[model samples]
Target: MKKFLGALALALALISPVAANPIIIPGDKNQRLIANNLYLTTDSLFAAYMSENLEQRRLAEMYVIGVIASSEGESWCGFKIASPDAVQEQVYIGLKSASEKLPKSRPAAAIKSRLKEILPCKK
Candidate 1:
């Protein structure tokens, strides 16, 4: 048991630094670019919205819904959406407009920023 534990500690120590460093292939600049921009962007969200696949559309709607739900009750930019269907439509319109205007922005940030404009909380 002692020998096995020592070997495990030595193995983990050797693997830690390799895991910490990102793998960069020579002359593969695109790989580094992709690695840096791994998170969802508005362009991808717009693609999902325009996709013919039902699942893609559903997931995009859900993503918008999540952004809305998370921003609720915040005194600054909270919004009161009427119904699930209506909220989806309204937010989609907002997202579509935002995608056209700000394609490079993060979707969650875009949606949150538009919440007050699209569905302002009643004062």
Candidate 2:
């Protein structure tokens, strides 16, 4: 009986982290909603950046700065962007470089992956 109980406990412990969702930083319901919206906006801007209209592409770049600024006010996925300008620069660079590498990925997923590489929280 004790062996069975110990095995069950070990199994639950092993499964828990695998089942857990990535924690939305400093986690709160409101922050999760805001983060989700910001992620969506960033995705849209990425799509617009590919537009043939030069003006549309320029506007999309500008909008990415705004989205990054707003994201600073919400929860992040363990990124540690220091200032608004820094975030803007990082996002701009990510859009330019990372977008090319991930041609087949959804823009939001690609952006998120890029940002994670650029600005992970210090351990």
Best by TM-score: 1
- Cα lDDT tens digits, model 1, 56-118, are 567666667667778766522443345567656666776788788987778777776665666
Tell me how far the alpha carbon of residue 103 in candidate 2 is from the true structure, in angstroms, after superposition.
Answer: 2.1
What TM-score do all the candidates reach, one by one? 0.57, 0.39
lDDT of every predicted structure (CA atoms)? 0.60, 0.49
Query: Model 1: residues >4 Å from true position, as ranges?
Result: 1-38, 75-81
Please provide, for model 2 over 14-49, each residue's C-alpha lDDT reduced to its tens digit, 9 standing for 90 to 100. 454411311112223334324433343333455556
Question: Where does candidate 2 clash, by residue pair?
Answer: none
Error of 2 at 116 (Å): 1.7
Instruction: For model 1, give the 10-residue run with minimal summed lDDT.
Output: 18-27
Error of 2 at 81 (Å): 4.7
